[model samples]
Target: MQIYDVCIIGAGPVGLSLAAALQKSKQLNKVLILDSIKKPKFNKQGLPNQRVLSVTQSSREVLQSVGAWDKLEQGRVNPYNRMIIDESNGQDYLEFKNQQAHIIEYDNIVNALLEVYDGEIEFESKLEKIELKPNEYVTVNDKFQCKLLIGSDGNKSKVKECSNIGTYGHSYHQMGIVCTVERTDQDSEVAYQTYLSNGCPLALLPLYNPYSSIVWTAYMDDYKYLMSLSDEEFLKVLNSQLGRYAPRIKSISNKRMAFPLQSLQAQRYIQKRIALIGDAAHSNHPMAGQGMNMGINDAALLANCIIKNSRSGNDIGLEQSLEEYESQAKLMNYTTSIAMELIKNTYENKTISPLRQLGAKIINNLDPIKQIMIQYGSKHPLGPSQFEWVK
Candidate 1:
């Protein structure tokens, strides 16, 4: 019997972020956030979570505005001033010298959002069912009512499923292996990745001092072989594979986790009074570290749309209002998703890899092109108008 202006399902960083942003913007008076999982706990003793996020400048701005950035422990945030991507052959290298990104523990972002969030969150509240009446409010499990429903749940979202929203995407036949690792040299603030002949790109992303998070994307067989090794043997293989990429891994902490890679997008981002964001709306390969970034953008854009709609005295959940959000967000997500897919395909195709490498070399030498790419990767370096909303 409790009616809220907005109810967001899934309390992950993206979902919680939306709740916080809405409250901060004063766009909605009452918002409800529900998640199946309990609140994420910060690891006090062991290694940080294997999951890491590359916070772009724009995303950092969003977090800063909501007070989440300040909530993040300063020691755990690693700011990478440079990034380099190249082939194992040392050809086709691209480097960005500016402060390209920051690596933050996943839980840090969530806790930060939680710190600033003043709205209601129902932990362990799994969404059992969702009822949707076109052009009307949505009902959740016959208990909660909301003028608008937002699904920030992951790829297999209950809200998206209950709304009968179709999706499109394909698996990359790859698995991403993630683990925390230590390197001998920690002075460098650069993140590095090398594309291997096997079509997998192994990246070393810096964490707090001396520690880094490894995201090695590999084919199924390669992944299986890597997983079969002991910790010591795995470290050796990693070092040997890197060849000349110095500062080898001294040791790896925590167990490695592997996830299937895919690019998925909902056929439509909105359905009547219900809308989807984050992984619920689109899930992309992690090669670019843009999955969560895209989700963050979704939350921001949706908040802006709702604010505009409410100010205009129009129903916030109406298709017209939601369309304004979907049009821009869907296009941006699609463009980035397709670009990533093409890069993956180009690298995976061994026959054309040489040409691809040549092309990369060409682009690397072109200052204007490289600068543009770097700027775009940093989330619209040209200006805030292109991508950023909500100031």
Candidate 2:
């Protein structure tokens, strides 16, 4: 049987990134990554994928540490420096004029991470079984063994299931309709988000010139209705709802896709020799676009803990070392999850409309407060100041 120092399940951005980070440690070798699907392929000439991520500055640093940030195609990466926030009533609006985030396609991120990762990857290798032996390596699928098992799969993670980890979260009873749309205007450097009267938040995120991606969070019934509409009809409704806050939508440039929204957190980030990261560990609302950011932070933190333990000649899979990772990651994830929920509820509650409007006005006028908000939104508070392996 083959034995590895670490076995990571799921080869998405998070898993691939963790592999890249681990490779920085000279003492750690024999790392393996397994994914059930084929490796992701990026097409430069094809239309952008509907799924996208708002990569924050903190996440950019993590990618930079692994040498993956430079591998991203510059033309495809869109950076938005200005953000416009408003509501359907137009009673108030908040505008921020600082560097916020970058919009990148999901495939682009995975491809970049895969390129920089120097480790073994098993594509189409689904994990069937996991056996945990006390103070010993974990057996995967009865074929491979590893001292530490990391789950970066996703919300419906098989590793979490086999490890008997439970998750707690509630569905938002909403779906996010995502698509690429062509805009008539040329203001592609600004990102726009509007809270509609119906209690859904619609975001128009900039992409390459004349193209922007839209994430419209709608109630279940509204999502169904929107999906049922023809392209033209859907564009009409979208433009009407956006009003003057966003650019005029010319047409739908890509196929529309919808994903259910929910906030999920694993009861515990680690169990014996196993640890979870990414969506497997926690997930939050997309309103703040921090889901992937949090996951990347998780991978970075875990890599730090593992490397520190290995250098000290301590067992990397021991609960004591793993708890260091869990404490920091769980605190960040839980706090972000609660903040997102509060934002969602605050905007949706009709009785608090007046107060919400007043608060928006107040926030807009207070430059100091707005600056603080922008800094927090653009960076993760718990992210490492400097990666130990980067030096």
Candidate 3:
């Protein structure tokens, strides 16, 4: 009987993140990461690296904790010192800056973490089944048992299914359409977004000085129409309405992508001794692009808690600890989901008033709100103390 201290059952950002996080754990030296894919080429071969993860300060600390931050590429990573969220009407806008928030290349961060943590990342090991033994040990793939099992698999986590954990939340009547565009005229390291009042998409996030990632969260039917447009026409339509604010049009670089915009959180992020992280536990609407960052935070928190418990000689990933993780995961995931809902409702619901938009405008202009938004959105803009996990 060969048992591991910890086993992660996913190779996405969340799973890799956990391996990265638990790499140097004194409590978990023997860890195995299993993924079903023979290789992580599922999206890599097609997607133009369409993702541009917005790394918060806490996320940076998380990467650093896992020995991956310094490995981030020098030039490929673009920093957004400032961001502006404006309405198509140009009347309402929210602005944040480096003193406000920051971001980085999505793939760069993931690959950096992988490069640093040269450990067991079994890409092709698809989890066919998982059974919790009478001893409460999770036996996965009929091969391994662990003191702990982490389902960082993703939104449709097989771990969650096998464990029979109930879920909550709704599939938003929206789809997040993502793409990359080249900027004709450039300015400071900044991002721009134009929120629509009548059920259109939300904002665009900056990827590079000359490029940005478009996260158009809109109705599926509407997005499908846009998707059918020729590349030039798509850029034209994107520019026609959102273009007036743009210096140049965009062309899909990464596999032109679109997925249903839904917010889902597992009813219990943990079951028995197994803990769920990232999309397995929570999938918030990406109106904010905070999903990856949030999962990174979860990895950091779980790692810290386990390490702390080990230092104090407590059971790592025990029932009590897993409960705490679930509680906190629910809170964080729910709070973020609601925030995204607020913005979504404001734009999607036709009954929303211009006064409501004004209220958003007023809120955005406030220094305290601005600071909190920047801090929260950027994951510890205030400093390390506020976000204790970063410490």
Candidate 4:
């Protein structure tokens, strides 16, 4: 048995982040990474279709710690200075503004994070097996007999599965069709969104000059038609629903792709010494585009947990600590998922329900409400609700 202090499963963002975080610990070492894909095998299918991550302040700090934040070009990732969220029932909108809310291309951030990794990566190495002894010592693929294990692969994480941890959610029946489109309006650096009676609202997130990232969520059946539409027809459909909110529409280019939306949470984030982080533990709807940012935050929390507890002369893989991490993560993930889904549901009503309209008016009219959201979304601007651990 190859005994070690820790072993990481999955080489995606969460996995890589965990591995990198562990490598940074002078108190810890003997970390090994095993993933199903080949090393450097990033999901490059969305090359043309840019991904925009709405990162919070805290998450941004985590990325910088791992050197991922510095790899991005200043112009590649644009800030979300303004946001327009509308109700389905009425023409009213809840708009928010912040000088600091930023957006980064998905692949750019991932590749950047991967660039700083300078350790063992056993890619194309699937989790063919996972054995957790009663002592909480885990053996993965009959290779790792380590004291700690982390599941950061993804929603369908094999580490979570092999451990027999139960899942507690289902699919949202919505798919996010993301793409890049050229914009004509030069002054449109702000983000814009519009609610449609046609179901599933469309969001136009500003990117660098002349391009905006479109995360169009629609029903299962409607997704095909939206994707199949030719550039001209697609632009027409988008113009009709989003023209008012979108900048001057020009050519829609880039790889357009769709991903099923889901709201999932593991029944327990820890089983023995193995801990789950990022999407493996909880997967939220992307309506808010905080998925990766949340994952980054998870990385930060666990990294701190390991560092704090290990220094206290306690086993970093204690059940109590893992449970605490889970409880904290579950609350935040569930809350964000529900909020995004609720906001999505409320956007399709033709009447813009009175209460919803009031919310729009309240948020739009009140700077505090808008700032609160910016703080919540950016995980910054410091508020009373901000957890002490994050600061």
Candidate 5:
């Protein structure tokens, strides 16, 4: 059996990004990536997919370092230089006057990373089992052996379960519904989000000309009613609810999708030779738009940790050596998740609505507080530094 240096399960953006980042490591050799899903296929002239991500500037730097940012540019990339957050009562508001984030389709991101990645990737390889020996290595299906194993398989991580890692989190009563529509006005450059009286926050994310992606977070009953509406009826309600913000929904570009919201975190990120990253380690509420960013940051930190361990001539798979990666990532992710939960609870709970309004008002007037948030959301403090990649 050829024991590889590292084996990563799942070929999603997180996994692919890790692979690309590790390719720059001088000491690492022989990486194996496995995933059941085949590579995505996108026509040159198709509309952007409904599953889009709010990519932070920090994330763009990571992709740029790996020679993937230019790939995204070939597709539809909408740069929203500002964000306008307002409440239902229209009393308090917050705005950020910087190119903080961009809206990119999930498929475009995955495809871009896949283009610059160079490694042994085995597609249609569903992970059935993982066995990790305390002082030895990890075996996948008794065939592929690796000194270190990584799980980027998302919320239902097979590697996490096989390693006996426990997770704890409760499901929010809300469901997230997403779709893309064309607005009457195509000149808006800012991302707009409004908190409704019923606690549902509707977001209009800028896309290409006259189009914006909508993410409406609401209770299941509301979700069901919206889902049940006909095309025209849905447009009527959406236009009415968003009023002038959305103008009129000329048409629904794609099929709508919904999923339950929850915050799940694994008890431990590392066990012997195996470590979990991305959604496998933690899942957060979409209200913050930090789920993908956190996962990408995890990959970067873990890669740096591996590089440092290699330089010290230490076992990269040793749980002790990998402790720093886990500690830093868990701390950052936990803090962000908790903050997002508090925000969700504050507005979602009717009793605390006034308090939320008051807090927003206070935050609006406080420039320092607003700057802190913009700094955190726009770029991560400890992310990988900007680098010029050889194109």
Candidate 6:
């Protein structure tokens, strides 16, 4: 019969970050986080984790607000100042020169958030049941009750399922192959993404010196064939495919991993005393590397809403108070999702190859247009930013 002001499900980066943000407010004392799995450990001495996030400037600011940015191991954070985009035909290309994004290990981000968040965490506490008590509160597993129950548990969230929130989106029917590779020339801090003839994009994201991470998006059949190749054979194919676009690969530094790609968005972000964030609410194709960044924004905006409501002596879980969060977050997530889908479809269309190449050249030469696109890709907040609440 323990009651908390907020109970967040899932202990990934997004969940922990929400916990950290809530813990920053003195008015909200009873906050808890529950995760079904044990705490993840980040080995600083080991090879970089296959899973990495491209932290944009906006995401960096959110982490800084919660005091987690400084906790990240600086040595492992690789900031790429430039990004090169082109087609396999090499007819035209686009180059963006400025601080674009940072490639950091997923475990590194989780560990940093854990360090900054000093709230109650229940590990191995799988959610079995959730009972809604109308305007009163929501109870989980008949053990913990909270005025607001936030779901940060990822795409297959139990909280989302129990709340009966329906999601709508289509699968890309593609897989993203991720792995760490050694590069002969690592002095350059640049990210290269080239769309192949088959419309798949292979991105080489710079990591720590001498190493980089690759995210190769391919159709299901091509993915299966690539995964079947030996390490040496795969490297050969990769080098031959990149040609003059990417740095020469010296060796495969980590085991290759693949995951299905899809774009998902919950029907609604809030229901009564329940709310959803992160992958629980929406997930997008990784082509833009904005999935994690979008989730981080969700946690930030939700935490800000909850904090402001609490300070104003308002009910945190009430629909009115949570509505703004839902509206804003959904708008951002939806816009990004649509943009990614359009990019994916446009690149895969063979008839638009000439126009696409011409457009890339035109945009590359237009500084203002290119900057605007970069900001959009970074998910920079616009007009009366919600981040003000964090400060």
Q: What is the C-alpha lDDT of each candidate?
A: 0.83, 0.89, 0.70, 0.73, 0.82, 0.87
- lDDT for 11 in candidate 2 is 92
Off by over 4 Å in 1: 44-46, 90-92, 380-391
**Native-referenced Cα lDDT, model 1:** 0.83
Candidate 3 per-residue C-alpha lDDT over 18-94 given as tens digits, one digit per residue, 9 for 90 to 100: 77766666456688888886653323323336666667677766677666778876455566677776667646666
TM-score of each candidate structure, all chains considered together: 0.95, 0.98, 0.89, 0.89, 0.94, 0.97
Question: lDDT of candidate 6?
Answer: 0.87
Arrange candidates, best lDDT first: 2, 6, 1, 5, 4, 3
Q: What would the per-residue lDDT of candidate 2 be over residues 216-332, giving only the tens digit for each residue?
A: 999998999999999999999999998466788999987789998888899999988899999999878899888989999899999998999998998898888899899999988
Q: Higher lDDT: candidate 1 or 6? A: 6
* All candidates: CA RMSD (Å): 2.1, 1.1, 3.1, 3.3, 2.3, 1.5
Q: Where does model 3 exceed 4 Å of error?
A: 41-48, 99-102, 134-136, 380-391
Candidate 1 vs candidate 3: the lDDT winner is 1
lDDT of 4 by residue, 1-391 (tens): 8777777887777777666666666557677778887655345334333566766677666666666678655556676677877634476777677647676776666677677777777778888788878466787888668888888888998888988999988887888888889887875558876666665668888776777878888888888999888888898887767835557678888767888888888888886788898888888877677787677667766776776677777787778656666666766777777777677676655465777777777777788867777777777222112222233
Residue pairs with clashing backbones, model 3: 35-125, 36-126, 37-124, 47-255, 48-254, 48-255, 81-98, 97-100, 239-243
lDDT value, residue 346 of candidate 4:
68
Please identify model 4 stretches exceeding 4 Å from their true place.
41-49, 87-89, 348-354, 380-391
lDDT of 1 by residue, 310-353 (tens): 77788888888899789888888888887888887787788887
Clashing residue pairs in all predictions, respectively, total: 0, 0, 9, 10, 0, 0
Per-residue lDDT over 261-374 for candidate 6, one digit per residue giving the tens place of the 0 to 100 score = 888999999988888998999988898898888888888888878888998999998999999889988888888888888998888999989999889989889999888888
Clashing pairs in 2: none
* Top candidate by TM-score: 2
